[model samples]
Target: MRPGIHPASRPVVFRDRAAGTLFLIPSTATASKTIEWEDGNTYPLIDVEISSASHPFSTGTARVVDAAGRIERFERRYGRRPAPSRG
Candidate 1:
């Protein structure tokens, strides 16, 4: 709540290029381009590679990793650790 200490937050347009979506929200991020929004106002434009709209997990297209197989393969290649002796 301190004045002139924190960066001022203003409306910024975040464009999700992958999802082809445009989001207008408050942000402190910088952008060189500007665009006219639906409200007939121009806001700072920040293009992002990924967002919740186009992310694998958010879109329910994420694939489950084969963790167990990977662990086994790593152990085989590096040699498994010896079991600890009971004191």
Candidate 2:
């Protein structure tokens, strides 16, 4: 709750370059560039490479690893050894 010690938080526009999306949110981060929002107001613009729009998890485009296939390949490459007899 300190007044002067905290960085000023203001409305800033974050532009996802890859997704071509813009989001207006309050942040302490500053930027040299500015952008005109839909409301006809100019705000500090921050360019980002990845966002929810383009992320694999968010878009459901993530690749599913096949553990069974990998195990089969490994067993084929190196033959499976016999289990030791329990004394």
Q: Tally clashes: model 2.
A: 0
lDDT of each: 0.96, 0.95
Any runs in candidate 2 off by more than 4 Å, and if so which?
Answer: 77-87
What CA root-mean-square deviation does each model show from the true structure?
4.0, 2.9
Q: Name the 10 consecutive residues with the lowest summed lDDT in model 2.
A: 50-59
- Pairs clashing within candidate 1: none
> Model 1, 35-57: lDDT tens per residue?
99999999999999999999999
lDDT of prediction 1 = 0.96
- Span of ten consecutive residues with least summed lDDT in model 1: 1-10
Q: TM-score for every candidate vs. truth?
A: 0.74, 0.82
Residues 1-87 of candidate 2 have per-residue lDDT tens digits of 978999999999999899999999999998999999999999999999999988899999999999999989999999887889999
